[model samples]
Target chain A: MIATDPTPADRSLLATLDRVLRGNFTRREALATGRIDLPVGRLIGLCLLLGAIYGICLGSYSAFNGTGHAWLQTLASALKVPLLFVLTLLVSFPSLYVFAALQRLPLDFRNTLKLMLLAVLVDLTVIASLGPVFAFFAASSTSYAFLLLLNVAIFALGGVLGLAVLRRATRDVFTPVPPGKALEPAAPVEPGATPPVLPPALSLPAPSSRTAHQAADQARRLLAAWCVVYGVVGAQMGWLLRPFLGNPGAPFEWFRAREDNFLVAVLRTIGNLFGR
Target chain B: MNFATDENLLRGGADVTPSARACLGVGAAGCALAGLGLGAAAGDVRTALFAAIKVPLLIAFVAGLCLPSFFVVNTVLGLRDDFRAACRGLLAAQATLGIALGAQAPMLVFLGASVLDPYLLTLCDAVQFGAATWAAQRVLARHYAPLLARDARHRHALRGWLVLFAFTGVQVAWVLRPFRGTEGFPVQFLRPEAFEQNAYVVLLDHCLRLLR
Candidate 1:
């Protein structure tokens, strides 16, 4: 005789994930169906003002230090060059635009903020690890390590404060119209009057098992794709820089060659490694 | 009779759909592989310890970025899957990347220093600014853009970009300034090397040139 089985916790967890994904997709659909009522110019102006303030703060810090001719100052000056800044901006803009588009979908601010922080944390990890390597290569001794630490610390501090301020300000500025305002208050029913009946089809559907399987599959695919892309890119970079690997200053001078030979050589080396 | 039939059905269902178990098994295997790779690459206990310290940081980063997405996706998909598991997997991936990048830091630093030769610090400064700005932009665009769009607060987006630009700007200025031989206070703060390292002194000397 067969025995009865208990519902597993994993089943419930999968069901919950499915619900979230569905909610976001539904919200996106709703927004697409709704009217666009935002004032673009005002928004742009606000952004510009904020940018100006930040710029002023940076400039003030530089001027007050009296060491504007120092290493930090030189770094800051190099960043001022339009071409370099623009190039960096261009590469990242598309990704930002996609993020903005995602934001248009209804999601909780708390959840969004959490994700942003996580991303920043990931970036910090990369930077921190990269820092020591840089110090080592630059032949920097113990004294210079403090500078690296300070730079990293300042950036991290700035990020935390910025996120806090942005969250508070956004909440105050973007109030949603209450549901009562959105729909005319249901005509006042007489005392004990029968409540308006909802259609049977409008009732929540029973959660399906099929949806859970599908979502898991999608997530797996996305993760795999991400891994592949990053892996390929990393490998390519490593290969291109291989010949210069053992050379004392090859990594530094690799970018200066006008001919494609250097890149070709690196690529061939990578190809051979992979081929093996 | 009804109870007996229901029990049979449940048993059959469980036996037939083992994908969750399979997925978990695969995930575990992938993690093991990653762990092994890290161990081999590190070679010794001390190196492993240093790398291990970065693991929590790596987890924090991945969780910080992907958790929301995981929640949102799960919510939208109506799946009740384990959010923690997803987070763990992503964090592991991030840690691997962090380790890989860390391994190469020495080379990058050396390259950066080489670029500092012949007073070519200006070019080195430019590269750092360019790379950092590029990275910052990518983060803002990929990670922060959605929140800005959702809230209709474009200011956050602008602020994000400006912060990155500001960072790059500062680095560039510090690299290119004409300092003959004295260590300017800012130079002291901004030196990218260890205090005892001659590179710091050399960099400080550059800052002093302007003072003279």
Candidate 2:
């Protein structure tokens, strides 16, 4: 039979995973920790100064690329940029809130940024590889199947990475403390002296059996609130924008002009109802 | 508390903590460099650099928000705050990256085309294939480093690397295969009709209307 106690290796792995999930420290915090000899804060300040210079270089490059009509290009880019940001932000918000709400762990902003960078890296990687393969096939007079495959591949990879990262975060964040081991001091103390008393605000209450049930109830209530808010807001917005987004062309023409099949007619009817 | 007491308290207290801060800074800088490298290789310096800067900012913001939530949840559950912090950090990092990409799609497209030259485009393609392999290896290494480090499991990492290589090879083959004697995969996928009706076209039309 397997031993009841966790192996040392398992413990170490768990600890490492914990560290990866929780932050190591912020630069300012590290300065206080005095763990390292170097003045990290000063270094970070210097880096920020350099970053400002880098931004100017990038802006100059943008101007060189004929995107100098700043007002127009900026306006155009800004419109689409926010739409994409909101879409992603909306999709990922639930996971973020759930991790924070359910787990109560400190989020590492730096690592979050790294993950974003990683996703972009992955996207670029896929695009890079796919470009050549497409070229080779095109040169060889191949079928267009590769295009569909490539798109599917890219989407699948992005989805997997997003899900993995989120799932890992959720699991790490919500990992339950084993019963009977929940109320220990955060730091070890010497035997002869009084234990280091955590500030009452920071000291966690002992885990009660009912707490899990209470958290579940809270989660349900929060989700319900979200649903109601989205439903009402969505309907109101759609109502307001209806005129601008209203169908301009004849609904019948869309189906009848293209094909006269029964399925097309049925689809056209449904489309018209929604479109109106 | 008095000013002296407050200063002492602040000094003693770990708001950000040392280890966490170091990890964040190093991770951010590494990501920035990786982004820049990828951008340069792809010939879209602007998109890459923007990604680099934006990612770190998003990480910092998300991490700050999630830390309190993590503290609350862990406190309730009687879990250690350290564990909670770790989980929050990882999630924040992942989410920040994803959001940054979504925010920068237009810049990516515009600069992607502008940056690529005949020679660089070829290099970009090769690098892309290699990147898939690189990513797979990194994931495996990260998830199973301890196990892989042992004598018995050392070969497993190599096996993982091989799997990625095999996957890339198949992709390369699929890309190079022949079907009809005409256009390539990208051209075929980018239908002319669809291109004509795209947002860019609409924007151009709007501009023309304004000019008129």
Candidate 3:
């Protein structure tokens, strides 16, 4: 399915990324095309670049403050930043595609993957852009608690914005395509009672149609539920892949033993910051 | 362009974008001058020289730290087209800050020389900095007026930038400390434990102390 296109000949990878960053891809007209037309491989590559940028910034705190193996800690962080998001997406994507299909939404497996990657691209872009701010604070401030909280806040902001982009795109997806512009099915039909197995000649019903309305409502509900699930998965993924911001007091290690969860660590950090 | 004669800096114009290089140069020079006045309070030329370098460095660091986040925000809001203008506005504001401070330098130096109590001298210097900051903010608003007219989203972005810049400026300034040299201590570019402390934590500690 992925190899059908020869190459995205017109747009360079950087140009494609620039368009996405400027939100040209998420516009209603663009979304109304009924499939994310982004080059998935390039999107993944861009996501990695953005993630690594932020990761290096994250690691610089350790590099400047740690006792030893500063460069190794930085290298580890650069690798892990992309891994955190990509791993979480890989882990959560199968269920996302299945649930989206079962809900009879417009997305196929490939389209679903594209949308997920697009959402992640948005998240990582925002985080990476704030990399300088993070590095600056890391250099200037000694309070580990403050840096931890700042990182959490940044991630939260990125996540919220990314989810909003996803919501907007998904809303457009639920709308029936304009007359005669019926979206080409990206995948073979699932055999058993799937709406995707459309009667080939029949044009999609108008916006007022009941099935379309029901599908939109279903998509909304699914999106809300999926957001919670994605957040949980992402947080846990980050927790499991610990030591992204290497603790200055500790020697460099690739991963910390999984002891406490993300929530507990955040609360404890807040407490420590406030002299509790 | 010529900031001194540019009416756009006083009354915002969309077309008249200030020269970023010129703004930066003027701002740094003005800030360096202000630093000399500030360090003169220590009654030593050596301290004055240190302050001269650190003041501009502090401003540059704060702005540099905040720029990426600001650029991304503007881009996301579909205001990337006006980014050059927005940046020019921001730079003009920084230059205004420097110009305002520079204008106050002679008075600050006079105040430093005249004041008997070191605490009073510090208080007066703080008040001057606050006043200059207020002036700079006014210039920023003038610069931002055109942008706000173009898109209401610019308002949010402007507010966000201000909060971010101020928060970062405080921390950067704290880390690049001893702008005002302490009595009986050797003059140094930074306090020996400069990076060992965090400004927000110190503020929290002070607030807790007050509560106690």
Candidate 4:
């Protein structure tokens, strides 16, 4: 079981989530000290809440357009969106944890879990914040293809931001810098002389050892592999829980016939939207 | 309150808490004055009264609907502590919009008096509203600059709020229709089919018709 810290008044789950997004929790000091005190349980609750908010927006498309009992589609979507992310994480997280252990990275299983949850929460929060926009468009547009395309675009944006934060957090937490190893100070410029321009290639620090360089490469490869796995699993999970926006012509169903994959469906939708 | 000494509104300073009432009063007064000029296009007193009521309503109603979501976003992004400052800035921005509208009211009035074509009057009203919105955005940017300097996330938050505000504003304006009364149609607060029609759907239909 992961150790629990005393919940302080100031460090509410919302505030902690905020700090995570702002890159505060990923600072060298916080990572080095192993002081990430995220409330996992409360955060899960927050994720669910955020997901439900966005789901309602997603469902609004159906509510406005779908035939038969459309409100149920909204309710079903609210329940399914959070489930989609959680299910995807469950499917993909074990390999990530095992990879971290193999690499002897700083992240233990618990921290890995926390980081994953934080990333998912970030994704959900962003999607929820854009709920109003989605609802507005959903209400305004009658075309099912247009709404589907718009949703894909919104989810893509959320996924990109979430992955970026995850990458940054993982890098900061896993790579421990030795004490007293700091960036070289800039040389003072002579009075009235132009400053030297450092080449972009020369700006980055050289790896101190061959093993460190290998480890860094391995970590980057692992992160890339894991991101692909997560994204694929997430897309498939969303596909499995189909009918997010109930088709205007058809009656509402929780899941549609799972014939095509996400990418194929998206391509078809784009083709249909543009009359190609 | 003395308008010039209202540092929060005038200078975009967050040190002092700007009065909410002052912001609302100024914004409503200015927009209402502009509405009076707009309604004069039809030379009808009742239409003028209706326009005065609706112009402020359009501004306030849109703001009201968009603010709750913005607050939630700000809280999650850890800007809750600065919520009051942000709100003050927003209100000041609204006040700026009102002032801009009020400033352009005389021009609208002049156009109303000189122009006989209903299309020209409608075009003039649209131009003034667009100009006022542009002016309001300048004030909003000025007020939000300090917050943006403090945290870059404010930039996204402010941008999101503006987009939501504009989206909802367009819909609300559509629903509260007939700002420039038709020459023959009886003057009423709203068109008979206001609620039934949506701005985006109508625009889309028009586009499709054009293509055909």
Better of 3 and 4 by TM-score: 3
Candidate 3, pairs of clashing residues: none
Candidate 2 TM-score, true structure as reference: 0.27
Tell me the spans in candidate 4 whose CA falls farther than 4 Å from its real position: A1-5, A8-27, A33-36, A61-67, A95-105, A136-146, A175-227, A270-276, B1-18, B43-50, B68-84, B109-123, B148-156, B183-212
lDDT of 4: 0.74
Output the number of the DockQ-best candidate. Answer: 3
List candidate 1 stretches off by more than 4 Å: A1-45, A59-61, A68-89, A94-276, B1-212
Query: Which consecutive 10 residues in model 4 chain A have the weakest lDDT in total?
Result: A196-205
| Fnat of model 2, as a fraction | 0.00
Among all candidates shown, the one with the greatest lDDT: 3
What CAPRI class is candidate 2?
incorrect
Q: Which candidate is the best by TM-score?
A: 3
What lDDT tens digits, residue by residue, belong to model 1 across residues B11-96? 32222222333333332333233223232232344333333333333333323432432343232223324334333333323333
> Which of candidates 1 and 2 is the stronger one according to DockQ?
1
Evaluate residue A179 in candidate 1 and report its C-alpha lDDT on the 0 to 100 scale.
24
Compared with the true structure, what per-residue lDDT tens digits does model 2 show for residues A104-193? Answer: 323343333333322222222223223333222223222122322332343344334333333333233223343333223334545875
- What lDDT does candidate 1 reach at residue B129? 35
Model 2 misplaced stretches (Cα beyond 4 Å): A1-86, A91-145, A176-276, B1-160, B171-212
lDDT of 3 by residue, A1-276 (tens): 211242464267766766776776665444554456676898899899999999999989886675488788889989999999999999998878777776655656776798888889988988998888888788777778889899999899788768877877777666655544433443564587343222221233455564656756866887977787788899999999988888877777899897989999888899898873
lDDT of 4 by residue, A100-168 (tens): 666555655776787788778878877887777678667655667767877887788678767767766
User: Which digits, one per residue and each the tens of the lDDT, describe model 2 over residues B121-194?
Assistant: 43553454355335424433443343334333334323522443344433333332211112233312123332
TM-score of each: 0.22, 0.27, 0.86, 0.76
